[model samples]
Target: MWSTCSLARPPKQHPYENRGCLLNDDVSNLGKVLEATKQTLFSLDTGYVSLNRILCLFEVWKTFEAKSPSGLCVLMLDVAELFNTFDISLANATQPADMERIPREIEENIGSVQLNLRLKDALVTSADHKASNRHGPGKDT
Candidate 1:
């Protein structure tokens, strides 16, 4: 029961009309369109900020050749790795017992943050992560 829908074309006054001035330009129906697009196209439901979400919006902006937010470094990470990313001497730090690939993933994350992590316990938790079998990847518990 829908009358019209065009996926291949945008409205006549699209956000591309004002390109780089999206934030400063006069808001009009395009604001509605932007909101609609945010709801449908942007995977902003969670604050995870996945690369897919960033790339999806980038693809849209690329259509307009829009610039800014430049020199961006996109990182794809497993949520678990985000738990910690700081350097600690293995001799003094408490690390979780490594599971199948958990330690490897943690190592990968280390490279991305190598320049900034100099403190110990940056990701330490109250849980007995070393050998407790309470849940999570604690020895594949």
Candidate 2:
């Protein structure tokens, strides 16, 4: 059966050569998949994570990672350990020395007064704009 299938191809050409065309696409798409996964996980509110999300993450990781059943038990064990101790890492994260002072990078204007207030005002204005359904900067009717 396999020999007959090879007869359809031109002589001196291997049957699987055409399959290489997608290799580049597959490699590039892996990065996109990782970025989308990162965004999905990052947007989760607070510490909330569901079993469905966990399974999906695991499946995607395994698909690009192990791709075989042999290594999965250990991978699962490692993932379990990582998730189990993730809280410790988060809890140990350092806080800004002065919470009241907004860092200039995030401050509305570097070296400007009332930066915090400006940030608040910006947020309020954005909310108003969204509510009014007028797109930014001269889209108003």
Candidate 3:
């Protein structure tokens, strides 16, 4: 089986630590699939929603609220790890046949996949910056 070397880089905002490396190629492929999924959702007319983007939105929305909810509140969940942990049969049960090719591509490109964090980060950060920049400026609402 062919495999590619993976590197773990420390986030610029965080202090460097010698974190142990993980070598699962599927994880890399999973990242690509996640990104493609995000793009697909974004391309559709429905509001684009991704884990980090939604989290960033919630953070911003919280600032205007006077108090946290006392009763039921919506929570965003992270199920990324489920891709690596769960059986493919579980996914097969829900995934449509037309969508089978992407998973196949992911499996085929396992070792070759590159994880994309910067794009998602930029989307969230830029949206935040744009919102803040327009807040005090004499711009049409």
What tens digits encode model 2's per-residue C-alpha lDDT throughout 25-141? Answer: 433354344443321221122332311232222222322232222111111111223334332112110113211222322233332234223322333443454546666567766
Q: Give the TM-score ranking, best first.
A: 3, 2, 1
lDDT, candidate 2, at 44: 20
Which candidate's TM-score is highest?
3
Residue 29 deviation, candidate 1, in Å? 19
> By TM-score, how accurate is candidate 3?
0.24
Query: What is candidate 3's lDDT per residue for 1-141, written digit by digit as tens?
Result: 211111212233212223322223433353343333211111101222322232222222221121212111222233245223423212221123212443454346421122122223333444455567778578766
Which ten residues in a row are the worst by lDDT in model 2?
A: 1-10
Where does the lowest 10-residue lDDT sum fall in candidate 1?
Answer: 1-10
TM-scores for every predicted model: 0.16, 0.20, 0.24
lDDT of each: 0.26, 0.28, 0.28
lDDT of 1 by residue, 1-141 (tens): 111111112224434443432222222232334333312221212333322221232222221122212211122223244335322222111112212222343346443234123111211221233234456563555
Error of 2 at 16 (Å): 42
Which wins on lDDT, candidate 1 or candidate 2? 2
What TM-score, to 2 decimals, does candidate 2 have? 0.20
